[model samples]
Each structure stands twice: as C-alpha cells, then as structure tokens.
Target: MTPLSRTCRRLQDSLNSFSNTFIFIFTTSHVRTSLTPTSSTPNSLLNAALITTYPPLKLQNRKPFEAQIDDSLEQPKPIEETAFDALKPTRLPSNVPLYSMGSSSSPSHTIPVVSTFANPFETSNSIDASSSIRKPISLWPGMYHSPVTNALWEARSSTFERLLDPPLDAPPQSELLTKTPLQSRTSVLYNFSTDYILREQYRDPWNEFRIGKLLEDLDALAGTISVKHCTDDDNMTRPVLLVTASVDKMVLKKPIRVDIDLKIVGAVIWVGRSSIEIQIEVTQSTEESSDTSDEIALTANFTFVARDYKTGKSAPVNRISPETDKEKLLWEEADERNKHRKRKRECKREVENGKVDDRLEALLAEGRVFCDMPTLANRDSILSRDTRLENSLICQPQQRNIHGRIFGGWLMNRAFELAFSTAYAFAGAVPYFLEVDHVDFLRPVDVGGFLRLKSSVLYTELENPQKPLINIEVVAHIMRPELRSSEVSNTFYFTFTIRPEAMKDGLKIRNVVPATEEEALHILERMDA
Candidate 1:
C-alpha cells in the first residue's frame, strides 16, 4: 500500500478507539447520577453536567478524515446511538466493569450501577440509584415494558414543555426558563381535534360527539383548571387532589360535527373556603369553515373541592377577587350557589333529625305526580306509565377512573340516555338535549357494586302541544350488601325539548298518579324547586 493510504488507515483506527472510549466514560461515570430526573438537581449542577458531556462526537474536525478513506473499501457505519440510550438501564452483562467514584469503605460517593431489565413487580421508593432496586412491569404476557424509563420521559417532558401560545413562535430557551407571575397565573386553553364520526373505533356513524366522552373531557378540564387556579407564583404549594362535587346548568346548544376542533376555555370563576367553581365553555370550529366567530356549543359550571394529599381534609386555596363587571356577576352567582348548597345541607340535616315542618307534610298530602308502580304486582300501574324507565348493572373496571371508582360523568351519561329513551317513547319524537339542571354527586360509587338507575318524568308542559317542555329526574343507587338495602348516591335532573309532530302515529300520554305520600312528596319537592 502507498504511504498516504497507510496514514489514512491509521487515522481511522485512532478515531474508532476515541469513539468507543468516549461512550464508555460517559456511560459509566455519569449514568447513575442522571437516572433520576434533573428537575430535583440544582440548576447549576445540571448545567455543568450538560456542558461537560454534550456533543461527544466532534464533527467539525471530520473533513480531513472523511475524504482520506478509499472508496473501494467498506466505510465505517455512522453511530446511531444517542446520549439518552446510555441512560437506559439494562441488565449488567457481568463482564462489564464495575464503576466507583472512590473506595468501597467510602461508599457514599460510589457510582451506582442498575439494570434496565429489573423485576417489574419491585417497588422503587427512593431516587438514589446507589442502591439497586425495582419490580416487573406486570405478570401478564407481553407486559414487561419498562415503567422506569417511561416515568423519566414524562418527568422530563413536563419540566421542559412549551408554555407559550400556539400561534406565536417559541422564544429562546433562556427566555423560557425565566418564568413570570403572569405566565404562572393564566387561563388554560384546551384544544382537542378528532374525526369522531369517521373513526370506526370512536364513532358509530353519528354526526355529533358522544355525550359521555365530552363529559369525561370536561371533568379532566375541570381538574386542570382547579390546579391552575390553586397554583401560586412561588411554587411552594404542591398540587392537591381535587374531586368533582357537582355539575350545574350544563346546556348543549348545537350539535358538534365530525372532524371539528373542540376548543375549551376553563377558568376559576369563584372560590369559597375550600371549594372552587370552574366555568368550562366548549366551542366547535373547523378548518373548512370561514366563521372565525366563537360560538359556544356547550357550557357548564363545575364545582370542585381541593383535598390535602396527606390528611385528606378540605384544603384552603388562594381567594380570587373580581376585577370586571362579568367577573363580578359570576362571583355573585357563585356565592348564591354556595348559599343554596348550604341551605340544602341544613334542610337535609333537619329531616334526618325529625324536625320536618308541617308545610312539607302538607305538600306530601296534596295529590302529586309520580311514575313508580304502586306495587310490584300492580301491572296496571306499570302499563299506564309512559315516561319512566329503570335499569341496573354492575360497575366494571372499564368505567372506572384513575381513582379506582366510577366517574361522575359516566353516571350522568347513563342517566341522560335513559331519560332520553323515556322522553322519546312518550313524546313519540326526537328528544333534543336542552340543559342539565343539576347533577348532585352525593356519594362515590364503588367499581364492582350493583348500580340501579331510575329515570322518571317530573313535569311536562302541555300548553304548547306541538313543542313540549319535559323535566326528567334520574336517581342512582348502590346496593349495600352488608345493610341489605340500596343507598342513593346521585340524582340527575335533565330538561329536554321535543316536538309532538315528529311522532309517526298518534300517541296518547297518561298523567302519572302517585301511589304513596312519600313518592308524591319527592316528586313535588323537585317540581317546586
């Protein structure tokens, strides 16, 4: 070989040796320290580590070696590895060198080595990788995915996620790292896009979005808004758990079409001692439409209560002050709602204490409308009712939330569907959703418990025969095995507008007759309220 060719070969060999050494040094020296999230580490220390280890490959000095290799010989394959891959834990191959920062007696400074293929069932309690640990991802077949790596990615993404508006170009990292009070305290805007009607798994050839799915998104948004409101500029307070207490005055105005952008704006409208009311407004827009207007498709007021993570007691949050006329009105409205809730609680306690007034008793004695059969054997009563329906089922895991319980919105969806069926059968027409008067979550429903839902017509206005106003009541009960009885968990009130002209045949409706004073009083209480 010529002298030039021999020199080129020597340079390529030296380059390969340097590449291997560089990978080994970083992988062994720093992998353990970087296993945990960098968020917990000091910013200066993290910056120093990044500066020391970044760009392991020096590409600027490559041109001399790049042209020296003969075209006839096979070129070396480019290194497709990344710095992140070195951080991934894998089983120690036993032949690999055991690394340490100092002697064994001074173990505090040792560089801990961990395997990527740790047991999936083992629990990791500490961020210190100094002591090797963990569990198998799962026992089921094909369920051995690495949760450790997944968690690391999630932590990294959340810490560095973009915080600016979508349309605006992102600023430099230096600008983004310096967060301001205004950035911390801002209304959260959530945008979700889906071709709901065209996707086979998500849709059923329906043009409008599913009420259940929409409600789930709303519940999630409510929690997000609550967190955003409760968060402070200091970052001293950690995120607290918030539960949905009630949903009121949810009005579905227009049908949300397929392949549309469902935009939601959620903000804290009112705050009480420990509970906050978030107003979530949903609007539907599409890329094809020229209408830049924001038309609300649905809107609801959701009340949530923050709970201390450790004590599980009601936690106080920062109070909000109204600055604008609209804000003042919402604040007053929320105050009124809080007062109403307090009054209802007091009334319930009064009834439990046997301090019922004579006026309430008199309302019970008056002839009131009810839909329940007088007796289980009363076939005539069942046949006469046209606007009542009942169904029962066991709550399964599929309907459960991360809290391991059935979601409030799932119950609402069930109630709405049953009520719509009853209304459709009675009116002999298509029932259009108007509004949800109230969805009071009295108690949490267990995942595996028997859920019994009863939907009945509370009131119907026949003054306008063509267009009738119907109010439906839905009550959910969970069967208590130990007590041998069912306890009420939730009550949903829905209002719908239906047209009698849409009926195929002439359908005659019969008025509901109350079988007992208690049932009559219950119906009357809802109607009067």
Candidate 2:
C-alpha cells in the first residue's frame, strides 16, 4: 500500500480500537447480568466474551440499564485528539430502544451491535454521511460546505465557486467596473492590461468588433484607475464610488480583426482635487512581443471622479507629481483642458441668458475675414442634405448596476449602436469606427425610465470621394412618463470612415442640413471647442 493509504489504514484501526475499548466498559454490567449464578465465571474474561455472543435471556418487565456516562468524554478537543468521537451517535433519544450486545440473531430477537470491528478495514468512502460528524475546522455562516469531501475554502476573495452557482443577490457584471484599491504607502497609480481577440461573438453585422464593447471596457478600466488614484493611507479613506465623467479624443486607427491580438493598457495620467484622467491605449500585434512593428489600433482619454459612496458628494484625492517628461506634458494639458472646460461652461451660461459676447457675435457674422465669417450659416447649408436616425427603449433591470441605476457603459453602447446604424445608412457601404471625439454623461438614468437616442450626420467630408469621412452626433435623453418631459443624459460625438471606392471620377456627396440657427450654432460651437 502507498504511504498515505497505510497511514489512513492505521488511523482507521486506531479509531476502531478506541471505540471498542470505550464501548466495552459501558456494556460489561449488562454482560455480567446475562450470566446465571450457577455458571462459573472464567478468570480471563474470554468466557464473558463468549457469553455475549449467545442469545440474550428474556426478563419479563425488567428495565434496561441506564448507565451514566461521564461528561469528560464530551469536552471539546482538537480534531486529531478526538478523532474516534466521529464514530459515536451524537444524540441518544429516549424513543430509540437500546439493544444488548449479547442478543440472538433470530428475526424476532436480533439486537444491533454498534460494530466498530466490522468496518475497521472498510474504505472511508463507504461511511454514511451525517451532519453529526465533527468538522476538522469550523466555517463562518453562509459559506458553502461540500457534502462529498466536507471541505471549504477561505471566505475572502473566493468568488470562483460562487460564480459558478451565482445567487440572485449577486451584483451585475457592470458592478465590477470599479474595485477597491489595495492599501499601500507607495506611489498612487493604476495599470490595467488586458488582451482580446476580435472574436465572432464580439462582432456586429459587418463582421467588425463592436465599438460599444470597446467603450464598455474603456469605461470599466477608467473607473478602476480613478478608484486607484483616489485611495491613500488616510483613515478616513472609505470605499469611494467612481463614474465615467467623459471620454475624449478616442481614436480608432485600423479595423480590428479576429486574428490580431488586441492589447489595451490604461494608466492614470493626471489627477485633480477630485478628478482623475486615465489614458488608455489599444494596440494590435501579430505576435506577443514589445516590438515596435506592432500596429497602433486606438487611443483614448477618459476622465473620472471620486465621489462619496453614500452622499454622492465629490471627494478629494491625493495629488500626483509628474516625474517623466511625458507625464509633465500631460499634466499641463490636463490643466489647460480644465480651464477650457470652465470657459465653455461660462460661455454656455452666457448664451442661455441671451447675452452673447461681441467676439462670439463677430465670429457669427455673415461675411468678412476669419473674424466675421458666417460659420453658422455654412454649417446650416451643409446640414440641409442629411438624414437623421433615432432609436428609443425603456431601461430594463438587466442594464442596471449595483446601485439600481443604468450603467454608463450600457448607455454608451446604446448610443454607439444607433450612431453606427446612422453612419452605415449614410455611407451606402460599411462604415468603420474612427474615433469618438467626445462623450459626456450628464445624468444617471433610473431603472424603468424611457431612453431616447437620437443620431444625426453633423458633418461629412467627401473631398476625396474615394475615401469619405462622416461625423455623427448621438444624444441620449431620459423621459419621465408621469411628467411628460425628457432630460438630456448624454451626448456622444463620433467619427467614421467609409470603405474606399475606386472612383475614376469623383462623386458629389450629400451634406447634413440643420434647419434652425440654434442647431447651426450648436454644431459650430462643438467644432471650435
């Protein structure tokens, strides 16, 4: 036998020996009473053992022995020290009749002996399973216990088994977008690296990887990076909530194919008092290496904010100092972007109050040099030839996050899908995702709310008719059924490139048509911004 098998055999033999020794002392009195006074008692107890094998004598109205067992045996001990106790019955209820060992084997008079020797060499797997068996180690409540092996894993971070058999209360996949950062005294940063192939399952009708899935991953990665940047050694650093504030300058350079290994990496580029900017880069390679020959597929910048998990108030984060030249450049750019964003907000407020600045009015004039060129008028003329597309749906529970609200990724997906459809129809051929210049999530959408997504061809460049480029605007609004009103939730700006056609002679392209001056100005403002 193998050493393990031998050891198990020895352990079983010891358990049987211990049980027989313990039970022998308790049943000796009953054995002695079975012998008649005329019988000669053997000095060696071999005779007593022989007598126990015989049929028990009937005693009319005689009560069974009520022997009191010492409580010392019941005291808790280490599993190794009290292994034999596993063989004993846990409860001895009064309703079960106790049988004498010295009983007949006949059907009417048979008495069952709790046999330790009969199964001494039997396989351990043959033992009947019962909850009464003492566990070698105790586990916390709600943890799973195996019936076959009686083994358990550590509760912390052990979601592998639970994932296989998920409970109804488990959080949706979107809830994993942001995870708590590991506590550390080192530099505050996050690095995300994941590889994906353009599998058929992730493709759209055109057999290209869906831009929505890419955006979803980007949102999740950005959220994780934000959480990592916000955490520090401060005792007040509670679990912080993070959300995607904006996605900017996301460019897709090449079409992703099923054969290419798409590698995406994300890292914290800059941090503000309560905001974090994460730069995520997507690259494709024929082979796994650090070779420069690898193709650059896409690049994106994402902004996220740390908020109080409970009150939803903005929370401050630790500052990051730039050490590298690239970091320094990005830090400066982040500051400039923040300033420009503030100025844009102020400009919007001025426009909303019907107080346009002289400079803006000059920029909007009918005809002059660059300062007085009627850009809005040109934008309106271009929008006069395009078709608009729209889609709407009621938010469902499946799209909800752990917070019981629609996930930002899901909203981005809906918007991107509609935008793709609009671009495809306008291009008269397959349109590939080129870039998402900007996407801003304005407000959270509650579950069961009506979601309206509108897409339009904001601009198109067909100067090179062989290769046309189209820009689309996708807007999301949440509608309240009771109020009969809708509030804007998101605005997505996307750019797409149509497949090149062999045009011996150039083809004239149709343009987007905006009817109102407000629409024209809105398009012009975004272009300038």
TM-scores, all candidates, are: 0.56, 0.56
- Give the poorly placed runs of model 1, Cα more than 4 Å off: 1-206, 231-239, 285-294, 321-325, 343-387, 482-485, 500-510
Candidate 2 deviant stretches above 4 angstroms: 1-198, 232-237, 287-294, 346-386, 502-508
Candidate 1, after superposition: displacement of residue 25 in Å?
64
Full-model lDDT for every candidate: 0.56, 0.57
Question: In candidate 2, residue 133 scores what lDDT?
Answer: 38
Deviation in angstroms for 47 in model 2?
87
**Number of clashes in every candidate structure?**
11, 5
Cα lDDT of model 2 by residue, 294-407, tens digit: 466777788888676546688666567666687688778878887888898898777778764454443333322222444535542344224588998998865654345676
- Residue-wise lDDT of candidate 1 within 406-450, one digit each (tens)? 766677778878887877776656676677886778888877989
Instruction: Output the number of the lDDT-best candidate.
Output: 2
